[model samples]
Target: MKSIVTADGYHVPVLLRESVDGMNITPESVCIDVTFGGGGHSREILSRLGNNGHLYGFDQDMDAIDNLPEDAKFTFVRSNFRYLKNFMRYYDEDSADAILADLGVSSHHFDDSNRGFSFRFEESLLDMRMNSKHSKTAAKILNEYQEERLADVLYLYGEIKQSRRIAASIVNRRKTKSFKTVSDLLEVLEPFTGKAKEKKILAQAFQALRIEVNEEMEALKEMLTQALDILKPKGRLVVITYHSLEDRLVKNFFKTGNFEGKADKDFYGNLNTPFKLVNNKVIIPSEEELVINPRSRSAKLRIAEKL
Candidate 1:
């Protein structure tokens, strides 16, 4: 399959069928594709739908809107999935039969070295905004964040062991000259943690900045809660997460309302479970798929049914 370019000018198609398989849609089902990156998954879902079915998609990046299918069954919601409930109100749809989210960076984003997603792209501007229209950029977070706040982002989001040290180095270096490009920042942090087995220390640092610039976690949390609420009873919720943090959040919330909790029971023994997990275990891409698309290596697919 040739890569499809998203309206945002990047190309990527990750976990196409695997992500939508859990949806379990019917001809009349109304599905929501929350992370409409390249519309690859949207195309699959649309094909699965009958003439009466509807597919609503959300994407914060305006460019993603270009990929929207101009059909009665499909609609492009050009907003963050965080505000899914609000958008649903506009569509007069309170609940959906299936909701799918593929949490990841699109090929369009990474291939464009200037997006600052890849560590290999050194001279490109340190701009990692998924939606270039947004005012905040990764450079602002690195150069302007307080050392403590910066450390928190790196530690919590990136899980960087030496978050404090890295943040301190960034702050110190910025005093004389501000960091403007990947090369500028990567060079300074390399000494602290030089090339090793992976030699992708630059990726770790870049991930931290990208996560902060997008506020990925916060938006994810909001989208999850909203999507669950808008799910019809017995509605299928399928999510494909790229990293452990996201997988943990999805897994924990599906198993227990909170990430960490046992099934609580009252004196009458009513189990407190918002949704039931259809797949007791997480699903990963098959080896064949991995060989074809290495990016799917980190992908984890989980499905749950609304109670």
Candidate 2:
């Protein structure tokens, strides 16, 4: 039982014990932590590995570099997990024993006032690129996207009911004053904010913009598809997802070997799938953990083994 303390509260790994345990790591197993935000989960994995074991940590954010661990067995890949297969091939590794992906945004991103991940900071610029190098920003989406496209993002990604109305309002508002900061967007959203669910609604709106700016869904699909090719027989795939959209994708892929989640029947009527579900029921943070880390309340962990 190893305890990992993040550097300056960069991120507190959610479901740390269950996620790692699900990996079923051996003393010489090779693993990859795709969402290596704070190195909390990666450090724990390293502690359980022997000298022969190796762990690769992937992160697109420049801030994650500061949290890299000092260990010979660990390699830090400063790239997005969408490029997992490419990097693995580049390193001459044919397959991995286990792969872990914690898809929640790090606390450090929301806490940083300048990153525009949180609407709590009124004056913050609407720049939600996980990798700062990305050209698209939340402000750009709000200012330039067509009303119909904007509505689709809000409705499909954010699950907002008033997406069309909101999109119309944004286009109308941007014509007079282009959205540059969080406050500017907040002003346009003022009408949509309900009395009780204001915070949740605002959070959803921000999440949609962030997803669009980062192309999160496309990346997740690509990474998951590539993961199947990279995992060895009986290799473990442990994922911790925060939102329903991503959780659904992971659940579907783990159950049916495809994003559609359709179960095909064989001659004996048995479902044919490439992976076996490790936990039929999704793992979630315990009540004790919830009290300690409120941000982890929405996290759900799912594990699968390659067949």
RMSD of 2: 2.4
The TM-score of predicted model 1 comes to: 0.93
Q: Which residue pairs in model 1 clash with each other?
A: 7-63, 8-63, 10-108, 11-108
lDDT of 2 by residue, 1-307 (tens): 0112345857677899999999999989999999988888999999999999999999999988988999999999999899999999999889999999998577788888999998999999999998999889999999899999999999999999999999999999988899999999999898999789899899889989988999999899999989899999999999988899989999999999889989998999999999999999998899988777877888899999999
For each candidate, the alpha-carbon lDDT, in order, equals: 0.82, 0.91
lDDT of 1 by residue, 1-307 (tens): 1233445565545667766778998888999999887788898899999999999989988767667787789989888888999999998998899999988676677777767877678888889997788878888888899999999988887788888998899899999999889888877787777547234556667777888898888888898888789999999889888777778888888887666556677789887878988999888877877666666678788899999
Error of 2 at 58 (Å): 0.2
